[model samples]
Target: MGWRIRNGMSISIWNDCWLLGFPVRKVTSSQSTQVDLVSDLIDMDERSWNIDLINPIFNEADIESILDIHMSNSNQNDILCWKGEGSGLYTNLLTKRVSISNFCPRCNQSIEDNTHVGRDCPYARKVWRLLDIRWSDDASNLCFKEWLLRLFMTHNKGKHICIAVTIWSLWFARNRIICEHQYPLFVAIVQKCRMYLRHFSIRTHVLAWWKPPLEPTTKLNFDVCFSYAHQKSCSGFIIRDSAGFVLGSGFIHTHHITYVFMAEALVILQGVHFAKDIGITRSTLESDSKKIT
Candidate 1:
């Protein structure tokens, strides 16, 4: 029914036989085959689902004919979309489930919507500005799918990927607030996008390289304590040999540093110093702060 209105297509609701076409079905009781059905449903192509729900005439057999693909398994209990996501604080932090609380997390006035976080939220807009990308308030005011398609259409491949990373970074930033009750600065969010994109490049076959880099040949192993005292933040950095023996360590103190970047950069600078201090030329760095490195 939603699909009918979505495409401005008309369909007869009177036919019970036609209703069988809907993938929204209740599995039979005591049937182990429900797993298979679920697996089939999960494996079904996005386009096929669009067709079945849109046409409003295709039967179950027709749906099957449309799929015609092999099931990964007859036991479909493992079949899931966006697996490993569960109902928890972290899950609630990421997804917006239907509930009473719809107010914007930051503004506390506007309804929290996909577009708000992806483009319209003032925090998100600030983050975008820091990246040297201007947001068209009028264009970004559109809904999620429309905004995404527009970005994909208007920008180059690299810019599109950057857009994806930007959106993901914004969502991750929000999650930080929901999970840890810490509000990060706009610069930190942009820096996070850069770091994440760099790490992603290493993990995946995405980018060739990042600027101002020497391949991170030197490593700073830190088992340091982090603390904020007397309005100053401090951390310790330790450099270790290949055998895990401690070469040397140093203390890094920062004033008025609320976020992790200053500490991270200080640790790294101390690491390079430790490398020079210990007469070691090249090494790799490791840190317990996984998010930082």
Candidate 2:
């Protein structure tokens, strides 16, 4: 008999052995099941966090076991229509029971589905172009499944989350337009995504500040290197210990440089200031610039 996973419960299986049950003989059929389990693990590694937006495409049992979230089909097309394309997958909203196209606020146009609202909708298309993104030309023409699968495959952890968030925000904007009979603006949607991604990166520790440790006894020939770079001059410095251990390094951003001597002088000055800040009183200052020397 085929193993069954019922709704409202979670479980795992390996080689015809239930995680909570007695072990069974290693049957060849069980091999296929094991392969699926391994694939699920690999997919999970691609993401840093998991938030289910709708019923998973797979069976409820597999989703429950893998995602740790219960899965059920709730016919969420109406919600999808309200939210813009590329969005609904990151939310917990209930999908309306009615078929999405049964009623269209934009009755002048055909009922909007996933592809229509996301790719073909006139308003959404304008938004995509403004952001310099190109969706498929024909909403109904492209291979939707293939396209979505590619998104999962190509994006890195950060960009992938951005993609999901972008779609979700777009959908939310669409819903506002449909329900309030208000016009949607493209800039608003893009801005919302930018803010959200920025915040998400901060919260997830993806975007962080770099503060190097102080070095007390760095012995470098050059305390700072100042020179003109590009049209503008910049100051840079290298820190090393008395034993020649490199401590820290960086350059500062500044306006255009007037002359090379000024650049080197500025570099020395900045390096001394930094050394002072780091509690270095007597550092051996050296520079290739004879003027600074």
Per-model lDDT? 0.50, 0.46
Q: Given candidate 1, what's the lDDT at residue 259?
A: 54
Q: Which stretches of candidate 1 lie over 4 Å from their true place?
A: 1-100, 135-138, 200-293
Total backbone clashes of candidate 2, pairs 3 or more residues apart or in separate chains: 15
Give the C-alpha lDDT of model 2.
0.46
Estimate candidate 1's alpha-carbon lDDT, on a 0 to 1 scale.
Answer: 0.50
lDDT of 2 by residue, 48-96 (tens): 2133421333355444444542222221100000111133232222254
Please write out the lDDT profile of model 1 over residues 133-203, one tens digit for every residue: 65466666676777777777777766766787888778767655643356888788899888876766665
True-structure RMSD, every candidate: 20.7, 23.5
Tell me the TM-score of model 1. Answer: 0.37
